[model samples]
Target: MNRFALCYFLLCVSSAATAQDKEVQAIRTRYQETAKKVQLLEQDPQNAALYVHRISLNDKGTPWPAVGNYKKTIKFYFELGDEQVHTLVRIDITSESAAHQYATEYLFDAKGQLVFCYDRMPDGQSPENNIEVRYYFSGDKPIRRTEGKTISDKPSPEQQPQAKRLQSDAAELQSLFKAIDK
Candidate 1:
C-alpha cells in the first residue's frame, strides 16, 4: 500500500522477469547449437551411423505388400567418435498411410537428455496445409514450445505429457539399438 513497499515489490518482480528471460535465451542458444550438430552430421552421411527399423501392423505375418494396416518406420541417427562411443543424436518416426501421414523427430543432448522434438503432419495434399509443432527441453522439462507460427516461452499442460512420451520412446529405441548393435 505504501510507496516504498510498492516500489520494492515492483523491483523484485522486474528482476525475476529479467532472470527468466536470460534463462530462456540460454536455452534457445543451446537448442540452436544442438540443431546445428544434427544438421552437420546428417549432411555427412558417410561418417554418421544410422539404424532403420520397420514395423508391420498386419494381422498375418506378411511383409510390405500387405497394405491394409498402417506401417511404421523408425530411423535412429548416432554420432560416432574415435573412442568407439556412439551417441544417439536424433530419432525419426514416420507412420505410413494413404490418408493420414505424420512424422516426429526427436533430438537428444550430449547427456542423452531429450533436448528438442518436432512433429509434422500434412492436413491436405499441399505444403501450406502442414501442421508443425516443436518442443525445446531443458533436462527432462520442456522450456519452450511452438505450434505452427506461434511460440510460447512456457510449456503448456499438454506438453508435459508429450515430453514424457517422447523421452520414453527415445529410451526404448536406444535400448533396442544397443541390443541390435551387439
Candidate 2:
C-alpha cells in the first residue's frame, strides 16, 4: 500500500480503539454511581458503608501535598463477597502539620460499626496513649469496638490508614483507558 494509504489505515484503527474506550468508561461510571446511590439510599446517615465514586473526592478539595509527599486522601474499601460489603474505612487529616500522619486508619463494617485499628502520631511523641485497639468476641459475632464495657471484651475503635498518594497521574490514567477503547 502507498505511504498515505498505510497512514490512513493506522488512523482508522486508532480512532476505533478510542471510541471503544469511551463506551466502556461510560458503563463503568454509571455502575459506580449506581452503587454509591444505592448505599446512600440504604444507609442515609452518611455513616453507612462507604463506596467509591467516579470522580475523586480529593479533586474538589484542597490540592494534594507538596514535593516528596503523598497527596491527601479519603478512602473506602468495598466487600468482595455476595453484595460486596464495605469492610474498611479511613479519612486523611490532609494538613501539613500531620505530614506523615495524614491518615489515621480505622476499621468498620458495612453497617457502620467500628472495629480495631492502628494509628501513630507523626512526631512519635505519643506514649502508650498512641492509638490503642482491642478485639473481643461477643456471642456469635465479633464486637471489635466497645463504648465502655471492657468486661464485654470488645476491640477498640481504630482503623488502618490508606495510602495518601495516587498510584498514577490522573490525566495519564484517563488517557490510558481512552487509548484502550480505541
- Candidate that would win on lDDT: 1
Residue-level lDDT of model 1, residues 65-132, one tens digit each, is: 54534667776666666687777767778875544678998777677777778888887776347788
TM-score for each prediction? Answer: 0.66, 0.28
What is the TM-score (0 to 1) of candidate 2?
A: 0.28
Q: What is each predicted model's overall lDDT from 0 to 1?
A: 0.70, 0.38
State the lDDT of candidate 2 residue by residue for 29-118, as single tens digits. Answer: 534554574467356836644443222334444545553333444333433346543332322223233234433333333343332233
For all candidates, the clash counts are 0, 16
In TM-score terms, which candidate is top? 1
